[model samples]
Target: MPPRTSLPRRAAKSPALRKIAVVLALVLAYQLWLVVQAQGKVGPGVGAQRDARGRFAVDVELGFAPERFHILRLQKHGRIAGTDGHVVHLRGVAPAGVDALAREYWIRHIEVPRRGS
Candidate 1:
């Protein structure tokens, strides 16, 4: 019998294992890209303008028309004040809730509501 060899040496010698490893790596990279893309959709100063109760008022712009499911998801973080076209107005959202809402794929952008709008 031969002496024990390292795991990297064995994997390197097998083309099948190398292919599996490459595929797995690519899959991981794609998942990471999705997370980054979601995070980037959040606008600057989102969680900055909070009310006295430490709740935020924001307008979430969606990639598509607002639906019941979308409203429900937003309601998880705050109350849905109204919806206009692709934008949904949310109030009473906490700072941590803003981060969680930003991770939704359908949410294109989340920003503080404009004045006098």
Candidate 2:
């Protein structure tokens, strides 16, 4: 039998290229939106301070509406316990803009600190 001639092969393009690009663009837009939301924004929040009794106490309040704050107590304390016998004392009133700011802050900060020092 005679030798077989070699056939030309078509150059390959990644089939998933378009899908990957779309995903990247969407992620970028979401991140930009979050930045715009958090920039120079002072949302309603309370800062906690540990008292001599080792109880978490929130002092000082910053927000737009006081009555809408629904804060019966300016400072509230809570005790958190772990299954492994770990206990954490936490105190704070739920902030007004916490729901909206939480997402923006989390995305921008990437991780939350145990406490702001």
Question: TM-scores of the models, in the given order?
Answer: 0.71, 0.31
Clashing pairs in 2: none
Give the true-structure RMSD of model 1: 3.1
Predicted candidate 2 versus true structure: per-residue lDDT over 1-117, tens digit per residue: 987554322112444665777899999999887767655443223333335653332222223232312233221223222111121122432443332433333222211114541
For model 2 the TM-score comes to 0.31
Q: What is the lDDT of residue 1 in candidate 1?
A: 100
State the number of backbone clashes in model 2: 0
C-alpha local distance difference test of each model: 0.86, 0.36
Worst 10 residues of 2 by lDDT: 79-88
- The residue-level lDDT of candidate 1 at 100 comes to 81
